[model samples]
Target: MRPAIIRKPAEQSVTPNWDDSAAARAAFSWQAQAGELCGLPGGGLNLAYEAVDRHAQGRRRQHVALRLLDRNGGRCDISYARLSSLSNRFANVLKGLGVQPGERLFVLCGRGLELYLGVLGGLKLGCVVCPLFSAFGPEPIETRLRIGEGSVLLTSEALYRRKVAGIRERLPQLRQVLLYEDNGGAVDTPPGTLSLAQLLAEASDDFAITPTTADTPALLHFTSGTTGTPKGALHVHGAALTHLVTGKYALDLHPDDIYWCSADPGWVTGTSYGILAPLLLGVTSVVDSGEFDAERWYSILETQGVSVWYTAPTAIRMLMKAGAELARRHRFPRLRFIASVGEPLNPEAVWWGQDVLGLPIHDNWWQTETGGIMLANTLAMPIKPGSMGKPLPGVEAAIVSRDEQGGLILLGDETVGELALKQPWPALFRGYLGQEERYRRCFVGDWYLSGDLARRDADGYYWFVGRSDDVIKSAGHLIGPFEVESALLEHPAVAEAAVIGLPDALLGETVKAFVSLKSGIEPSAALHDELLGHGRKRLGAAVAPKALAFLPDLPRTRSGKLMRRLLKARELGLPEGDTSTLENPR
Candidate 1:
């Protein structure tokens, strides 16, 4: 297929904050941009100071920093100044509890004002903060807490009782457990827990930001392994620099923009973009404390006047399943750009946004290890459907293959190989927690080998192939599962699909597809044959699925990523290892 570009109109062209496209050809300097981000006067760089206190103390004090939409149809606004005061009080509470700097603090709660307060306060106090998915099971939560060596836990009474109570004995290093009422109201603590509300009330409302260098460890995010326990990726406060730059260039956040990043704060995207990026840009961020509802999301976008939306492809697919007529009921005059992460956005979803919502969805790529967006379809650039666009400024990306002697050989354009990046990015994770040898395996000399297989086009745009392990080698040809899955999704009946390579006797491997049909679509022999034929016609017979199976629902992570490895395991009746991160384990 030829490259399809969605160009920006004259009137719709946005003035990007970092509009120097020529910078890509120059020697990018991290210090030049690092100097732009506000740091503490004397010395050191603090994430909290740049995110909240600076805006609070400056002219934007009265600006609406956070607009909270409650589950029961209530709205509350928090200004930068008020947020500063509240986070300061929370920091004082931590100080009064004798929690020292560099100690790990874990938060387990749903989307609410308290989660933001806890995170910002922990950063202000210079503690390594880790947010756990509130929906996680007890064992998963316990494993993270134990591995991170968390000393203090801030959670609600309900969550603590349900998920943490049984495993509390196992976490002996966890010295303090602060419990808050789930409804954002004051409540008495249980026998072993302390009341967070009471402590906040007793503590002072003013506290100075901790003096910390850029290298100070600020966040700990755990990435689930395919077989073993999750690996903790440690990131530092300097990552704020990446967040700031990406927010401006990739997200195109303006000062008056109303941004909504519909990712949970527990994930890296949720923390970096959902909370920190918008705050760092001094924009109004909409924080919805409700679950995913098609009507509710439309209403929020229309009523809140969302200008820039950062969400997942899973949500977009759900919206597509609901039909475009449902979206016609709402009007979004203020909405400009819609961006997606978590997984690759299929070309159909990108066109669906332009056809239904009057905008093309811009897809970006990054990982938990990268800490921020590495490649993105910037607002200023033309949108290439199904492409990850180009690398951000100051990011040097290449496609390289490994030689027999473990040396990296740079591949030319249109050649599929490992996607590698030049090292020492501001947002790169310092190391995998307590696994020095494992961290060493991620790098090859000056390049960090991203485990993804991709191809760079002649125009500098990068296209995602598949995970290195997920690529299929059949009949001496390599086939990317994404291309097959995307072609399947182009069919009207297929709402979701996962492609995997199954072992074959004649060929090395054969492509197999697991598909979930859209609503009102029924499974039948005729329909199955029709889908198989559709796949054969769209993707060539050589790359098309050799077999097709219909599933009620595909397994996904909490962050809305398909578990292809799980699909392959179930098909072969192999042992399903590490099912902790699965949203729906079958």
Candidate 2:
């Protein structure tokens, strides 16, 4: 099948000769296609085969592929040889259960050996895999099952009995349920359910992998929308090639580097960096299959000699709260790089990382549709504190001004406007699965509308402002919510905050803040004054919140991202649209 990404305008543009090394050049070369440079060829390869089988074929069979740490301090060191065999056996088990190629299969489990094997097995058989976060309740799970038309569910018996048992009646497409346990008793299989081990025992590991081309849809990643219902973003095999290029060049991943991405496999970050990127670079991936603790994470960095660490800004802030003395005592001798995603890192977080961890947390930016990191701070370049840095080589970005006439005018240096990509890279998603019209509208003229607002400096650095739809229009002043939110977070009493534009009698739309206070902090009229005063002092009176409401917690998605739209919906008493994307909505 021809690549569907070719339809994007970004895939039809001219590329510049960015002076890079031979390895970088070759990786970048694979990203170009259809008279445009976007993605690479996977050598007709499956990520599971490349990550496990290819590594095991050579003399380096004993090399450790995964280091899994359990909740009780137990550690399991898995070799590439064992991983290949286990994955192959599991693939046979899937086939025995009557699952076919081109079928949609869902895996709802935590980050462990079983989760990895299940995902790999499904891919090897040419089934599109949809991985959901284990933390999600039955509502979100059922929504995914219905939307995906899932044929089978690979989950723990405990979770099946608790979450899936009640919702099974709603999912008609679900034909079978497989448990990931050894204890096979007279437990209720719900008519068609079966045991995972029993099926594997009857099947053979000698089965051949199904032939899948680059254009075949490989993954169906549901974006955790902070506003509306989650949209499943479809990614193809060709997009995998771009993921390799991005991880290698943009993140500057090295083969010898022991990479640890602390993102859950449920989100896009997990798929892009945790699974695809590390495997493509042929690096040893460290997996901590347990809850995150500050000291434990630091210990992982010190004990494992992890060279590269990729995490979210929220995690960095949590570490900063633990104080720098603990970080000073930790010896991360092998750690050369640390990167942050999800949101642009605050200047304080960046400073704290450099001071405590001996490395600055380089901030990068991208969305679920973009596939991987489209903008990042390369190791060879100087680190900028708050900027998301320039566009990755082969990816084109611009800040275009939209006038009253709805014309998109490209903005010059130091000017703020809507951030849009001029070309589609290999990692770009084909379209929103089953939502063609909604996907088509995201592109304006020949560029993809990123919905983000940004400004480019004369030196080519792009600074993130906020989202276009979220921009606040007060009186005649246009304000980005991020600026005000960041200003409010700088205060000592504030743990987290969300700013939105509300209908006003005089100012047209006034800024309103819904804040979550820090521990031991009391929410009163005085604390409200203090928070607003802090914002006014830093961001000027124009962007300061006109009103403040104290909440115990902010509405967030299953992935721990704040959902400002939900708060807005509550404040206005408007009907909240599909909130399936949120873990806990107001």
The TM-scores of all predictions, comma-separated, are 0.98, 0.89
lDDT of 2 by residue, 1-586 (tens): 1110111223212221232444653555442522221221334656566556666776657777788877667778887788778888888888877789889989887788777877888888888888888878899899888888898889877778778999999898999788865233434555567777667667666657777766777788887754456688888766766777777766667767788999988888987788777766667888887777988999999888898899987778767666677788789888877889987676666666776877777788999888888887666556667778777767779999777887789989988898899756666787787789989978877788888898988868788887777778987888877777777877777767788889989988999998877667789988878887877888788878888999987777655566777778888998777677665554
Model 2 stretches astray by more than 4 angstroms: 1-28, 31-43, 182-191, 402-407, 583-586
Global CA lDDT of candidate 1, please?
Answer: 0.91
RMSD of each: 1.3, 7.1
Colliding pairs, model 1 = none
Error of 1 at 402 (Å): 0.7
Error of 1 at 582 (Å): 1.2
